[model samples]
Target: MTSTPLPSPTSTSGSTHRSPARARHLLSKVPEVTVWFWLVKVLCTTVGESFADWVDARLGVGLVATALVFTAVTAVVLAVQMGLRSYRPAAYWLTVVVLSITGTLYTDILTDERGVPLAVSTAVFAALLAVVFGAWWARERTLSIHSITTTPREAFYWLAVLVTFALGTAVGDGTLELTGWAPGTAVLLPAGLIVAVAAAWRLGLNPVLAFWAAYVLTRPLGANIGDWLASSRAEQGLGLGTALTSGLFLVAILAVVAYLTVTRVDAPGAVDEPGTR
Candidate 1:
């Protein structure tokens, strides 16, 4: 794979880049987009679904309480992440894992506790995501993850990410509700759609659009996968249990993150595109 040196931290041209407060440039707060990036992302999303469920069911904490706990954790983790001048795999992925759980919990709260219909939850989150993207693009003039060098851009990026997770959860669970498909069967749709998106991306669809589309689809894909693994055989799952599934995926994520950290292969400037590397 060919490698390109990462652009200067403040090299990106934009109105947001001119801020005096941002004069001291920061390294890109996000990792370079690569295959490893996507793999760990799906893994984290799976953990988000399984781990959140395990904690809720095993601890007997009410859903709202669980959401509150994770919300608090997310704030602390994100603060730590934001304080760093560059990406640390451990800190960045930790923030993502926590954000995933919190976002999933948010959707679950609306659906299960508030008695909101799945379709309504889906629509609401979709609209919310659009609003976030609209605001982000209007302010930053770019939604490309690679350009997240400023504090405001990073803030907007994380906000969009949280919405994507919540939106994905609602869309995933909602699909199951509306289709009445078993957990295993429900996984196929998102998987197929993701492949389609990837193909479109390689065929000249915008990379930013492609990335976010795949990102949102991954939530459902990962969640359904977690459901398939944890569900009982009667539920057309492997019966691994949510606890076991979460443990296995968490280990997988740790292994991958450690590799990325040590090798710095997914670090900024390592690889620009998947096929190139």
Candidate 2:
């Protein structure tokens, strides 16, 4: 039998050429949701929570004042982010970090300043999150982060994110109060729950459901880690202090965002097909 000629390398590369239109479309949007996205997000939230505490507690800014500062900063960052036509990782992640800090402070204000119990705060935030989700779903007809292409969707996305952080803070703190666990031990519950959620998703749970579940869980997971790292030894922590813990995670988030910006690692593309779990 005659041997068939092997295809040339040039031909193989040419066959893989993406149309300019497709390339442009991909470049003009946010990246497909991935593991890296979640990992960095958790780190950012951790930094936001710990750093806010550090500034208020160690630096003596006070909770209310620090909350006000973060609120202003978050507003400015989000405004800039909203003006962009496409997702930029640095901008997107910066907005997230700010929102995380602001959201945490919002819950703290309720629980600490207003003297609301953690359970009450948790219930209130959870209800608020539900309301945001309802509005987002009603307006956009889609809640998947994978389809965050329009201004309305992005707005809703950020709003939902803010609520999740606030809710997570209340829940995590409430759990601690109920169980009376130290910081180190407290980390395990949320972390374990998130792992279980991931496993369930892999086992064919609804993608949207899984995504939101994991998203909400990460706030507590990250917060616990931050607390465990930053609190004093008397508090059953590693004693890095909030300032150092926050600074470390912030630096890591910044480094990752910079890399993603340059590489366009998370940029959206048509290749990212939406999937049902």
31-124: candidate 2 lDDT, tens digit per residue: 4466667778789879867977877786567788888888889889989987877877888888888888889999998888899999999899
Q: Which regions of candidate 2 are displaced past 4 Å?
A: 1-30, 58-61, 270-277
Provide the lDDT at 190 for model 1. Answer: 97
User: lDDT tens string, model 1, 95-124?
Assistant: 999999999999999999999998999899
- lDDT at 133 for candidate 2? 82
Candidate models: Cα lDDT each: 0.85, 0.75
Q: Which pairs of residues collide in model 1?
A: none
Which residues of candidate 1, in runs, are more than 4 Å off?
1-24, 272-277
lDDT at 86, model 1:
94
- Against the correct fold, how does model 1 do in TM-score? 0.92
| Residue pairs clashing, model 2 | 30-268, 31-266, 31-267, 31-268
